[model samples]
Target: MVFYALGSKFIQEKKDRENTPPKAQEVIYYSLAIGHHLGVIDCLKPQITCKVAEYDAWIAQLPIDGEARRKLEGVKRFGEINIDGTHTHLLAVALHHSLPQMTEQQQQWSRELIALLQRMENEPAIYLLVRRHDDW
Candidate 1:
């Protein structure tokens, strides 16, 4: 959310984390949602963080049991895709850098973002490839 708010130079990235444990994901979300307090000497650049800690705290306290509560207890990161500002600007930027060999269309690329980047990363792929690409 805040990343796109910063600007429009985003490129899609894919990762496979099929075996990542739930606790690790929870810790990541908690870190983002409840952002760290900056030191006075720190730089003032805008930080990208989920603005949903209060809601998450409330949800965590609800009367629920077992996996349901555990899932909610995992911090829920929130994002709102700026349909006009971010998406439109991204479309324009991509078109500006478009190649003659590529079929660039705003209609194809400008769909409203509908889910968390983390969720997209963890989703099972429709097809699997044996080749491995190392990220690190």
Candidate 2:
């Protein structure tokens, strides 16, 4: 009885594998897989610096002070986009850098900033002159 059930389960799993969906979209700046599921195989894998001066105005309006404010002023650099589709998927919080490169402190800052931005009716859209791309 046990063998029979095991065989049936194995067959079902094989059938399921045959029908799995294609891979989900990849993370913007890295090989991180965001939406992969049952069918796709798991291939596990594995910054410049800049100053804050250019962003002075944008930072002034942030409503943050002290360390939080200082860190924002200290970021050196973020990316080198050599991979496909990698140019677009970075977490807005990490700049153009991959998620893994984000330090624990940075992560905390991201969360806090995200929360703060969420509350500001217009802050998220505010442009950062320092950013090379869009205003923000």
Q: What clash count goes with each model?
A: 0, 7
Tens digits of lDDT, candidate 2, 75-116: 324211111122112223333232244555444544543433
TM-score of 2: 0.22
Q: Candidate 1 overall Cα lDDT vs. reference? A: 0.28
Candidate 2: RMSD to truth = 18.6
In model 2, the worst 10-residue window by lDDT is 1-10
lDDT of 1 by residue, 8-102 (tens): 11112323333556676556443332232232211112223223443343333333453333433332322222122223333333333432323
Candidate 1: lDDT of 72?
30
Assess each prediction's global lDDT (C-alpha) against the native: 0.28, 0.29
All candidates: TM-score? 0.20, 0.22
Q: Evaluate model 2: give its lDDT.
A: 0.29
